[model samples]
Target: MLRLLALRVLVATGFAVAPAIAADFPPRPVGQNQAGIGQDVNYRIEIAAGPSSLPTVVGPVSRIKDIATIQTARDNQLIGYGLVIGLQGSGDGLRNSPFTEQSIRAMLQNLGIAMEGGQARARNVAAVIVTATLPAFVQSGARIDVSVSSLGDATSLQGGTLVMTPLRAPDGDIYAVAQGPVFISGFSAQGQAETLTKGVPTAGRIPNGAIVERQIEARFNDDEVLTLQLRNPDFSTAIRVTDIINDYTASRFGNRTASEQDSRTILVKRPASVSAARFVAEIENLLVATDTPARVVVDERTGTIVIGQDVKIAQVAVSYGQLTVRITEQPQVVQPAPFSRGETATEPSTVIEADQSGGQVAMLDGPDLQTLVAGLNRIGVKPDGIIAILQGIKSAGALQAELVFQ
Candidate 1:
């Protein structure tokens, strides 16, 4: 009895001290505090309530590199015409693809072999388009992967080797040379009356197949300002990112360094005392509370629906039902009695039926996505029905969110 009384007194004292401490603490900035900015974000965090209970809520924190990227460090697309050789009778026909014959003749002539013939008709060569992406700051002699696709009517490109093809950028300047054995993820086989194929045989890839012949001159270190492009453009997210970056830079380097240029772009001034790469590395690792707009994305083709947590509806009554129609064909043939002269015939019979599901009206005062979905589900609505209802709600100006259809 004495110990219980002492515990009660200690608990009361703890409760009395909590409010005093809470009142003295300063308020954090909007996005800098927990349960701010990204209330509807996808990331989750589990709060330790007790040993047996684990409840999760949406987390707002995200790294700079995960949400944004340096604008100048982008990939360049390079494409070229090439030929795949050494295929076992599974190549483009000379009569069908005249370009193949022309390319082969030109290649031989370049190699000092004069081809003075009607056509170099070979069933072992296939014309292909070689494509690769030149990475930023790629130096000469570095290798990159290339994709090869049949440019003509070729049966298959299995067991083929790509010839030396100069890959050029959009500016028409050669950047890399691709030549390697093609690696196909598919195979083709044929027997007398049946043929079997898996995956795509005419398209293949070669890992590290292209050797960089020329380097792209990118003076990244010389730039004084670096542009950060957000992967998903949003005004709230951009402002949050700028504030977080400025707060970090000001405390560490003694001045603000980041500013929001637009919803999709943020300009960060590189510090003169630090290298550009090091400064970017530091900025990219900093965490910020990201924000996303409330949206409902629906894919009609796949019957997929994604509802953001911040989505709300303004006191609407939704009524939903389904109409199903089924058609079945059943036929019975009549036979002649005692094998008499009568032609065999089939009778056509089809049964069609229609059903209408009972409609239910549900009043939804959705303050969040979960409540809205639960109310819709309570009315026994399918995904297609829910999509139609969402569209109707948007048209009626009842849904307080953007409705996106894909």
Candidate 2:
């Protein structure tokens, strides 16, 4: 009987089945060692035919909608002042945060309840600022998320309820109304000696907490031309986007309708035969490959290095090494012998040593990313050493990319 040898390979997505291998040699007897088999015998290996066990390749193309957005359709920011109540003695102190007390008195007066002349003293209320974003095309009565942050010295906002607050845009118009139970993911606990806290207890968010009260008019359908702004501005990417849009429009609509306005903007003329909304819906779904400038970013604090794909290094020589010095101190007590005048003293003994690793110069000339990494590895350079070497190469004008330090 023939024997079969199987091997398994693991991939990130999952495990793929490998073809089996057949050997011509017969199976060994039970409890027999491999050394018992004749060494002179030759075994033929065969693999059963099957599908390839390689992972699928993904291209760099992305939908135009992802890389660009309509200029007129953008979010509007809204802000308002509010109060959070129903706290378990973790609210702001009236003495330290006077705004909380004043807000409480004002709210009471508005509710037809008159407060005495004395100040309101309570540890269950906190002054807060409410913020929310009004999305484009949102109509009245649509709910959006809102965030609440303590405007006073409050310890926590957990299990607190925000009062009714009107959100106002920069144009001095109320856009939404937010009022809901504040949900915080953080908590705090204190004993006599120590306190423990997790996450941010002073800030919280409410999902679908704000209802839109007013709508900002966005004349999207009446536009004669559409402007697509690139998220990352690059000349090559802009040109590619223009070319792809024109190519698509010409092929489908029988006319070119796209032009490059600048390195960051592309203008597309809406055809009379097609509506503006339909034209944008069809163009934004097209796929285009993006391009970016070659750059190398280094973070010295974390010793991180990121190299772009188009980065290249000219012919250069690099050498890296580290020198370490160590010092140790030992003290010895000395005592005077017996009778006359006994005295004790301490003598300090010190030892010092230095170590320097050998560094060999490696010639590096990379026309691609893989070759550059291999050259750096051949020099036995670590991340820190690589950063220094890259900086040196940039200073020498041997690196053909932008070097950014963070």
Candidate 3:
């Protein structure tokens, strides 16, 4: 009974002294501030909380974007195999890469050069895979970037040019034609005993190199409803997004236009009088307040720790400090008396020292992220120690947020 009373008194004293230290502890700014000529505004904290007594912050709030609202449409991939010409002894070897030689012969034959019997000797050419992304709603004659990669052992494509290559979609239909000067970002060279190389010369890109020859006409007409897909799955965010969109355009549409189909997607009923394009435009302009859950993400390699504002802590005490150990080697040589015919000898000696910091213990009244982190920092918690402390808190049921490690 006496021991228990003394332990209670010690804990009470720790609580009183800890808050004073916490008051003196300076918080390290986690974000960068821009140096601009503008007045600093007081923004309300928009953090979401669960059923707990987590501390609340009263400063600037972070804005979140609905990923689907900003995206217009998706792009399609078109691929084809063709040949590159005008290489300086960096072309694919015909003997080793048979497919390169076959492709070269086929393209040459199409250009009215009959290789029926004779060897179509083209050492300065290379077989390549041509690829491009056909952007959504791209019309015929529009240009896009294309990538050319050597299909064989080509040394360099410094000044090479891609031949007329037909890019086809999964349906085996030609959609675009690519032909441009290759922009190789690397080179290769061989010396007597050394070799120097930079960026990859075998694979290069041609900006605005392909011309679309066909178009896929799939317009978001008023007949069909448009679906909004969430980049990250969150039920609360999804429902809030649906309600905000409906509330904004409910009067104009005479009915709710948006509904949460699931956690990852939202279905918006196309207003008959308003076109789908117009409905999407209006939805994009409106901002939906986000209620993001608290989560702590840590990058172990770089020792990066990011804490959410609503991260709560339970009544727990943490004590931590730095430990240092040092060792030194010393040697002593012993010599015999000058008159005595004795050999000299050497002796080894060592000195070791251990030092530890005067770490303190503090009772964390974690109602919010600020006080919780401040208390830890006050006790000399370093980056490495912070990681361990957070893990311990989660294990001890003090931390009320998901701990994600990367």
Candidate 4:
């Protein structure tokens, strides 16, 4: 019985040792490593050569707003000074912020209040700067949103109302006037000696705060000729657009070169027999094939990597390891001799330590996308790790696609 018990213990020890030895064993493939893993070659081949035509669907003809003339497709910024009133003692102090006081006095004077001096101490109003964008083709009386930010030392703009203020474009033109109740996304509460804030209290937004008072002219087809512009100035896309339009026109009219200043603008000569509006409508509905650049976008802040379907990497081997360094700073004190005039002092002693673990060099034979992903996963690398690996690959000239860091 004693011999049998000893044999059982020896077998258990052998079983425990087997796993540790297996962990250090070199990696081996269960099957032959080859191309076309988890992919159907027959389907891929069919898609590559099958169709050059797009499906026809009924939709609105793309207009100028849907696309842009490259030159006119830009946003305009507007800024103006405004007042936010009705705050419950959360506004700027009159003594600290003189501008707030001046603005309030001016507003009151405009309402026919005759003050002894040109100054007033008010704690219920804040001087704010309003900013907004005047979109293209805005009509008269159209309402738009505006953002209000405190220009003074105001603690918060909560429960405030914006006075009438004119929003001006960069060209010094007053396009819209804003006036509404401000809605602050944050709140503040204060005790006798302390205060707590949840979000930014100095900025707020007013929905539909501005009303447009002027109209910007946007008239197409006024002349016998018009132009169609490409959003992205690609020569290939421009040629394709021209071809698609010409095909729809049945060669009745041909596009002309108006000027050398802009290559995107192609003049459309109106046919003598057809109405210009009808002809323009037919050209906008035409669909053509578009090609995009092969790109891989990485956002380091969010640790996101967006890889385009056409992105391909060249054959390469990647190995990754981590190095951690620890440093400790301990301060020591030295005491002077008893009855000595010298005072005690403190000294700092810094000890820097480093630790490097043995890292396994993962052999990656990335011939295609599937193999590349599998190889990266084997090393326990996630999105953040992949970001670092991609940066390294780009530096080493192993990545083939354009690496864009956003």
lDDT (Cα) of model 2: 0.80
| Tens digit per residue, CA lDDT, model 4, 1-406 | 0000001111342321111100111211223222224643221101112122544423233443344352222345667888899999989898998878777777878999866854566788998999988676568899999999998888899999999999865444677899999998888899999999989889999999999876455433333455467675544444545545555555545432121113354445556666656766656666655444557899999988887545666656677767779989999999999999988999999999887653656766555556767777887777988898888877888777789998
lDDT of 3: 0.71
Return the clash pairs for model 1, or none. Answer: none
Score each candidate by Cα lDDT. Answer: 0.79, 0.80, 0.71, 0.65
Model 1 lDDT on a 0 to 1 scale: 0.79
Q: Which candidate number would show the highest lDDT if scored against the true structure?
A: 2
Pick out the ten consecutive residues of candidate 4 with the lowest summed lDDT: 1-10
Clashing pairs in 3: 54-367, 55-367, 55-368, 186-199
Among these predicted structures, which one has the highest TM-score?
A: 2
Residue 158 error, candidate 2, Å: 2.5
Task: Give the per-residue Cα lDDT of candidate 2 at 98.
Answer: 83
Instruction: Report the lDDT of model 4 for residue 60.
Output: 32
Model 2 RMSD in angstroms: 24.6
Query: Mind giving the per-residue lDDT tens digits that candidate 1 earns over 233-300?
Result: 98777777787788788888987877776788787878899999999999999987677788999999
Q: Alpha-carbon error at 247 in model 2, in Å?
A: 1.9
**Candidate 3 lDDT over residue span 60-170, tens digit each:** 322224455332234667778888999887788888888887777787678888776755556788888888888776889899999999878888888999989998765
Worst 10 residues of 3 by lDDT: 1-10
CA shift at 51, candidate 2, in angstroms?
41
TM-score of 3: 0.65
